[model samples]
Target: MSPFDQHQPAAKPLTVLIVAYLFPPLAGGGIPRVQKLVKYLNRMGVHTIVLTVEPPPGMVEDPTLLNDIPAHTPISRVPLPRWMNAFLGLWRRRSESESGKQDGTHSVDAKLHETAQEHGQARSLNMKQGQTDQRNTVFRKGPQKLKQSVQKIVGHALNWLRARIFVPDDEVVWVRGAVRAGMRVIERYPVDLIFSSSGPLSNHLVARSLKRKTHLPWVADFRDPWTENMHRTSIRWRLALEKRMEKSVFEEADAITTVTESFAQDFKRLYPARDVHVIYNGFDPEDFMELEGSPPNAPLTFAYTGILYGKRHPRYFFQALKRLIDDGMIRPDDVRLEVAGVLDYPGRSENRDALIALGLETVVRDHGFLPHREALALLKTSHVLVVFGDQEATAGRYIPGKLFEYMAIGRPILGLLKPGEASRIIEQFALGVHADPSDVDEIEEALRHIVTLYRSGALLKDIAHCSSKDRLSANERLCANERLSADERFTSEACLALEDRLRRFRRDVQAEAFYALFQSVVGAKQR
Candidate 1:
């Protein structure tokens, strides 16, 4: 028997069709979770056929993610209709044109300022810099205001149209084509199951249609909730339509799985008869195997990766950092905040501008959008990994995939989070400290505590000690450490328990969980 055969339901391994709109080569948006599932599931003898859209031009691509998938796995990348592609290209050009005009004004003003400063004729620039300043004001004040007004009007119209037309999501445009392609794949393969994941909940819509036609045992996975999503449209009509679509998927799919217990509980509460499972997004251990150990005694560094848009900005962290600098508790040079991934929400306030406004421009290093491996490697150098999420009402139901990635990197996480799964996990595992994302004072205290631990050498000592022994056994010694208080000893035991829990969250283990779910679903259908 094949080594992987034990994982199969029978002598024949199961075949599953994975419908994911965002898959490998797409940088973010819960793509890694779907990619990792395919990678490990294939290893355990499940055959996966992926149906994904061909990435549009200018979409951030991480080719490195594709390396994880087995070569034999069949993948179909359906291209968008030519007209939609043309429309996107036109939209991209207009956005670039507007950005270019703004950047040009800034560029000219910067060059003029540099010349005046180098000449050291500032007060005299009452005559020299005075003229420069007047010209700069005209450049910004007259044309910039006109442009902003025009853009705002255009943005409002576009949002209005989008709210009304894109019933569930913008990806609704791709559904008919995706379902057509899915039909072809089902016809081609001996597909026993249909699995769909969503964020652009369009994928589930496609799966629901497929399930209707094929009557296959289908599992609809929710990396995020649909209508309850913080980013969901607030328009009541749109929301009503989305809830209807969400209800259809919940009622139809044979099994439901989500990334967090909170999300699962919410789904179960709503649909009491549904099979809701919490199959968390996880990290592949092999990704970190080649990473170098963190440098000892290096200037304390905190790093964050992944997109920050909507209410997911680092405002609280910045407020705390500003206090640390002003109080002379930390020098800008001695500590660094490294940020990766998209910092803008496209038509919203830019995160980089916020940094400059707070005079953190020099202290914060912005590495915009690195490939997944490079991002991970960048994180490996940090003393603490940073995780940020919205503090909105829907926060508890959401968990950032970065939380799992940070855990696997084995760095203490500094989570700027609400009281939710992310915060609970950080405290439970003794993984790191967390402060309410909205509370600047709490964030400052968390920062101070981290700095103190770093300066006292206790932090590095603990990391080194953990590295030298089997983490599973370290809890006993940790409890015995006389340096800790009774509560701290309990925390030490919890720290070790994180490793045991981490095993359950490993991608391989998660794949087994998925496989078991697949067996139960398919077996019931067969009977």
Candidate 2:
């Protein structure tokens, strides 16, 4: 019934035990990738039993993503332990008896509320707007400031404690529980293949023990690098041990897969004797099939649709917009900035405060963590989309899972990335424009150039704007961009090429390849 779903001989069904730390109902970038993999793997005749964690702290769960899961696919979830929660997560109030209770130097929000009320201060929510404003002015940042100050003081010590503790990650505590649940499935059914995916290395660690015990043909999937990662703290001793652990997994894995080709090549060099597969992170085209198309006369808008905190923050974008308005390069009201995900880091709201700090709050809309379908709908209408990354040694290997979703919508993109895999792909497909994320001046220049094109009505022309049903056939629209002259930066022809390239990375295609590898590794096809 779908474009990718058509008449083809289904591959021999194999029972696959999928070990993943993140899955549907636990919202994040990684959830959809694994979710789609299971969806299409079933289409390709590979039955999967997914083992994942219960919803942990600070995740926006979208049960709608569960709609994408194939019916009858068994999902086994292991909850994080109570002691584990008390140690890693912030304090929770059991009752009014423990008011103003402090977890280290930081106090919980309930504690702050009681402290405020005790001082005879009018609480914001119960008071009038002006009174709320007064309360907001007096108490908002003071408690937050104290919490932040305390967090800063203990940040390094926490890092040291984390290194001593959650060696691979805080999620390691869930591995044993996951393995026990997985063994029940393995004993009940013949698990022909074992697959594990990770950003948190604990997922692989769980699969590692299972693979060793069961001696099943295992495929290790690394969504990102372990030792070379830029997102988390890397303690020398911990990293050295992880490298040893990484070596063991690589050595034992029958087939290894990574999201980026560069990372795959690195693993190949790490274990030259083993086979490595490059499976690019991509979008599920079917999800957008039922949505309405962007109507005409929509305001020029730029959207970033995932978590952007810490090093991934787009402060340069804000600075560029401010400078653009001041330099008369763009109108503040004519263009709008849309951010659709969580932007908090640790104790404070860095990304939120950044927008207010720049006085761009009115023009910049924060639709905090929408459901997957709603986020996709918002992205479909936008004139330009933003995909940004941090400055890191391994940044080139980091191709965000969302970039393909942006491309799938057939809109223009403004990527704040270095000249890495993501940038290369964007430039190759004439997706949009790119500027260094670390350089505000360069970002400002890129913004000016794109805004000029927007005013000239060129950016939207390259995108194949069609009704939802017409989208699949609208692939031909991107063809026109390829024939356009150099001046027509993102022509329809180039867009078509991007669309075609994207097909190779779609879930069904990638899952089919993975299934074939699974069969080959187990020698089941000949059997």
Candidate 3:
């Protein structure tokens, strides 16, 4: 028997420790992927222990989302010091401003003046050299040899204070807390593996620390690239250090998994000797239940969910729709574009003005942010799902988690991205249409094609028959397996049936031919 046949059932479940900074009640793109993974892992006989933060304020709590996890799944919640997080944000902003000024307007003389003022104030206040300067004296000297020397000393001192006050335990603080809590859990229970998911990328730090102490095999899951993530733009000096840190994580990990094949390739390229796995995010089959019975609705509602920030602009889609409206190709009242997600950065104003400028204000409806299930429900109601990708370096390398859920909806997709990984996946699945965002004409053509198909009542049939290759391949495999099984059964049941019949026929034929030849030979001899 084959090994697979002998092992009809799986072995004892794997114990997984998931370290993530963002978990439910945190509303973001990463949450769904993490939640689904844990839920599905449990379903597949994996015991999951989640270590995450208590959901930040202003986020909703949904215990039902945790239902997929086994009843006994361990959950560790670490409290983040809100004040420290806030201070870090403030300090980062100030540092950026200071760095920019140092490169631009601030002269060496002015910088010296600033430093002197700070130093005198520290002395007058009887404060230590590294003590507080109510003036927030981060950038006081320009980039000169002597000035840099003074700055380094003062900066180190300030960093010490900041670390003590803001991040008292450094980057591993959260991990240390989780480990302390997790150690107790481990002592009472068993953990087979440590799985860490990252974006705050800090989770890896925690996992790394835990692995050092526990010596457990660790899997680091990266939802996006670390350090080289397109969204991140650090100062030049910090870039090298950040790259080194990212490399350390990649090296120390026993197994690394990413969401997209392209990213897996990139990860492998960075660490040439490492084995990286590509596990594309998948959707729960239940998300498509609504689509099974529903017919396409009129007016063709289009929906886009998730944050559309940085270079992942929606300008192309808006422009094409605007042109269609302007050219009378599609009536304004005949279509509605619904965007459901947080717009702009947190605590910032909305992008209503930008949308208005693009002439999409009236046609586009902003649903803001909604719960995951609610968003999936909304997806079912739409005729098409819009998948937008940035044109930047990270464009096609990372497939958004939403693509999977969108696929699950089984609705036709409208992909506006550069011709790359995302487009390839969409084509491979026969999911939807793709257009180059750079070409308005192509975008218009694709949009019009959908409109024409809808009008002609051929859209549904076209989607059904568009991809038979995958189905045909599956059928061929099944046929081959059936033939192999039949052959095995025939050999076991009646192995000599054909051979016995053939042997009897041959003997009868040979005897008849020999007798005829003997008579012929005698007749010839007499003649």
TM agreement with the true structure for every prediction? 0.83, 0.83, 0.68
CA RMSD, predictions in order: 9.4, 7.4, 22.2
Clashing pairs in 2: 478-492, 479-493, 480-493, 481-491, 481-492, 481-493, 482-493, 482-494
**Comparison by TM-score, 2 against 3, better one:** 2
Cα lDDT of model 2 by residue, 1-527, tens digit: 33234423336568899998788776667776688889987877678999988866533467788988987999898998988765544422111112111111111111111111232222322432122133232212323677666666565455445556776666788989999998998998878889998856788889988988898888899887766655544456766877898899898877889888888888777888887888778777687665665723535678888756455777778888899888877666667766666344335555556667776655555455667787887787677889977666567778988887887776787889877899998887777889888889889888888888887877677554322335553243333333355675545555555557556657667776676667667775336
lDDT comparison, 1 vs 3, better candidate: 1
- Identify the runs in model 1 with alpha carbons over 4 angstroms from their true place: 1-7, 89-149, 293-298, 345-350, 465-498
In candidate 3, residue 488 scores what lDDT?
A: 52
**lDDT scores in order:** 0.69, 0.68, 0.56
Which segments of model 3 are wrong by more than 4 Å? 1-13, 59-63, 85-173, 290-297, 344-351, 462-527
Clashes per prediction? 2, 8, 0
TM-score of 3: 0.68
On lDDT, who's better, 2 or 3?
2
Ranking by lDDT: 1, 2, 3
Q: After superposition, how far is residue 415 of candidate 2 from its true place, in Å?
A: 0.6
